[model samples]
Target chain A: MSDILLEIKNLTVSVRNGKSDIPIVKGVNIEIQRGEIVGLVGESGCGKSMTARSVMGILPGPARKSGEILWHEPDGTVTDLTGLSEKALRDMCGLRIGMVFQEPMTSLNPMMRIGDQVAEVLRIHKLVRNREEAREKVIRLLKEVGIEEPALRYRSYPHELSGGMRQRVMIAMAMIGEPGLLIADEPTTALDVTIEAQILRLIRQMCVSRHMSALVITHNMGVVSALCDRVYVMYMGRIMERASTGQLFANPLHPYTRGLLSSLPRIGKNPEYLTTIPGNIPEAGREPVGCEFCLRCSDDERRCFFERPSEIETDEGHYVSCFMCQRV
Target chain B: MSEEILISARNITKSYSLGRKKRHIAVNDVSLELYKGETLALVGESGCGKSTLARLLMRLIKADSGRICFEGTDISALSGRALKPYRKRMQMIFQDPASSLDPRLRIRDIIAEPLRVWRVCPDKTEMERRILDLLDMVELKESMIDWYPRELSGGQKQRVGIARAIALDPELIICDESVSALDVSVQAQILNLLKRLKKELGLSCLFISHDLSVVNFIADRVCVMRGGVICETADTETLYAHPGHEYTRYLLSSIPAIGDDPVS
Candidate 1:
């Protein structure tokens, strides 16, 4: 079987306005392998979350998506997700793939018991035979997520649990279907530092134990370095750079990527000053005519203001798009 | 260096009733001191009462039993008009700038409100000049003075918040999770701005936040709190290098440091 579990090819998403289309997610490509944890790092309004939602076929209303999303099954069958019927897509959502959102409080139904919520995933996929079987599976899944007193927590509402425990329940719900691929959008953004560490560890452990793949969407580089094997830095709906986590951090090629890394404030070593990107992200559909990041590039050249730079492979599996990088 | 103390809170405690005769202790007998022209960080997790402590120090809410002295004068018992002069000396920058700013007012008016309330700037031209100067101090453009809060971005709104807080030339500013709502890059910009302003204006700050890494960057002294009580207090370097309390150690361990490997 092919090790490539999910592949995104030139995916684009745009919103329809009055006689115009506002491109939110420009053409971008990403690949996730079996048992690999990949990071999609970007700030707010950078389209990282939108790209993840597109992978799940859950783009919000009025947003039109295009391009190919290919899912390679363990049985050697490759399916194009964009061409699938609504019924087929619905079936594939829970059985073959799963997603975790930033805020678990809103994702979970406050009215329902935690046990029924996890069991509902199994029942919807027709994975369990009866109520007794579902109860046993739910208890085991809760325990697997490191929830103490599975029997007691099974009947507890989401409000009764703390933020960390609620997130664990959300993880249990997502992993109940034994999906081959998972998409997590800012999974630890709303959590405290201690709780964030636990959640990140839980996600990594679950993925490794199940031999599943993940696409972690976050703006935190620390989280990326700790959990992700590879990283893609996104900016204003486009992928500016992609490389292994170590390579990306050691030698960031793109100016935007370098600015982002340098702008982070560390604990001990305080720099004299931080390098800011000079300006805020451009409004959607109002990006520069040439390079999207040219407005904020400190070392902008003449060509950068007039011509868009194509993706250049600087090293093995390391890609960047910048006129300045091309000269090197 | 034995610096002059700016404000002192002695034996502060606060509590709220939980409907059925149960008392929820938000803050319990916590005392700390802020020095002149230095930053003191109050670090804790959610529901740890760091924010409640800030409110009590600012006198936004009365403490159950305590004495707060600002510049050697007890301000805890002062109320209404008696507190007006102290209010001008101590200002606050809230966490959510978007909500804290008045949406109907322009940036100029928003910043000039403090000066106008205190009668610091006598006339229109003086207020206009100070407003412009304040905007420039925060690195905001002169043209943004005419813009409303709703028209600005998150970082821009926060800059406006800082401009307003420093408009009255306050001696101390209480920044309650001021940078928590910002992105990393923008947070850096704001932090650098605050550092510059502190040096130029000789301002003392009480910065309250849940993120220890941020506290390490800006704080000269760190106070770790949990469950309405202070667990440890020490210099930033000492506290980070060798935590005196178990909770402080756990919090230090919990920060997602770069290059730390996730357990498989």
Candidate 2:
């Protein structure tokens, strides 16, 4: 039996701009197993967020999407969430599937008290029969996420809390319903190093203890190595490679993955030898005929310019979509 | 320890009254120094008063009780016109370059403002000459002289910031999270430029950042701060190789390296 909680296959997303339709997420595929952490690694404007947003059925308008987002229910039944209505989506979102957005400031309601805000989800979803039970559960959730003196913090507004504490609140809010899957999109990018480490550790710990799978979208490769067992490397709008953490770092089959690794700077190393990816991410509308990363690839092969290749499983539990990697 | 100190802070403390019985001790009794031609990194989480300490050194806010000696000058006590000359010798580059520079001013005028205000050069023509030189020194094209702050990239605007800070020829420059907003490649460029400027200008820098990897590249000495207190301080090599404090060890261990074990 497939252990996947979420499976996206050949997902294509296009947005209408001016006169023509543009494909931003050309063809992407990802799978998140139960209690598994999958790192979606890409640079800025590489459609990582789009993929995550699409999973939550929250992609903004002017964007057209196609393909299967098969979310296998806990009841052993499969559900197609792509065409769900807004109201239905809302009920499903905070209660069943929670998201920790990139910017917590935008994710949270600024004017409301954090306790009321956390309790709002329970009230909206009717998870609790009474206000007293909801209030108690909210405080418990806050304390569970490592917020100190949860009762005192319940009276504080989002603005009153520090950034690190606010993030903890966000985490607390996300875990109120104990959602089966959590999508953390650049959750620690805005945070300082120490606070970021704490958050990362917390998220990793909760994934196992809560029995919830997490989809972590970030550009930092080190975060992936630390937190993810499996990773999907996205370049432009497409997933160039997918592999277990060991196999991906040990043997990165895709050229884009290789370039990204070489470009990242390490601590206490010779700064003079730091390599850089030569070209910027391609414009959304104008994509390559073959490989999306062909222009930036160090060794652009002949087949890469003319033929688009599907993800080929060359190793067990590892896949790369590059034409060059397709050869024996 | 042999290198002559450029700046020193002895038992720096700062507190702000919150209008009640509570007084937030923003910066505790902290002591540190910057050495000539070396980068001394101040690493800490936010609310740890690292930025407040930077402001304290800049004299933006007076310390409650402490002594700041800048190159044999007890600048901590000096004020008004008495502190003017010391101000010219030291300058700061803020984190956000987009807002740091005035939106309305042209690039030439922005850089030349410091030169004119400090009277570093006599005539407008000489000022123009030096402004162009500063632009060149910061690796910015002279064609950008007519553009405003809004027209430049984050990196280019930051270059303009460097150009403005060095207009008066400061010996010590404080870069506060200068490249944290930038991508890694662009950050490397700025780091290289700063590293190179230190050599050519014989300047000392107090680099503040939350990223240990970036600090490790530039810092000769690293001081770890927590809850507005200096938890540990040592030479960069020693700090990384053998951390002394639990907080320091936690900070060091948090640095993510590729292929390393994810969890300990």
Return the interface RMSD of the candidates, in order shown, one decimal each.
3.2, 3.2
Q: After superposition, how far is residue B117 of candidate 1 from its true place, in Å?
A: 1.7
* Residues A1-328, model 2: lDDT tens digits: 5688988988998889999998888778889899999999987778899999998888898888998888888788887778677787787788767889877777779999999999998998989999899989998888888998999999899888878888988988888888988989999898877778789999999998988999999988888887888999988798889999999999988887887776665665546544655545556777788888887788788888888878899999999887788775
Backbone clash count for every predicted candidate, in the order shown: 0, 0
Flag clash pairs in model 1.
none
Q: What is the DockQ score, from 0 to 1, of model 1? A: 0.56
Q: Which pairs of residues collide in model 2?
A: none
Q: What TM-score does candidate 2 get on C-alpha atoms? A: 0.87
| Top DockQ model | 1
Best by TM-score: 1
**lDDT tens digits by residue: candidate 1, B1-264:** 237888999999999999899999999999999999889999999999999999999999999999999989999999999998888889999999889999999999999888887788898998899999999999999999999998898999999999999998899999999999898878888988988898799999999999887787788899999999999999998988788999998888887766533211
TM-score of chain B of each: 0.96, 0.95
User: What DockQ values do the models have?
Assistant: 0.56, 0.34
Deviating ranges (above 4 Å) for candidate 2: A12-24, A60-67, A74-76, A148-156, A253-256, A263-265, A268-273, A278-314, A321-328, B103-112, B119-152, B261-264
Share of native interface contacts recovered by each model: 0.59, 0.41
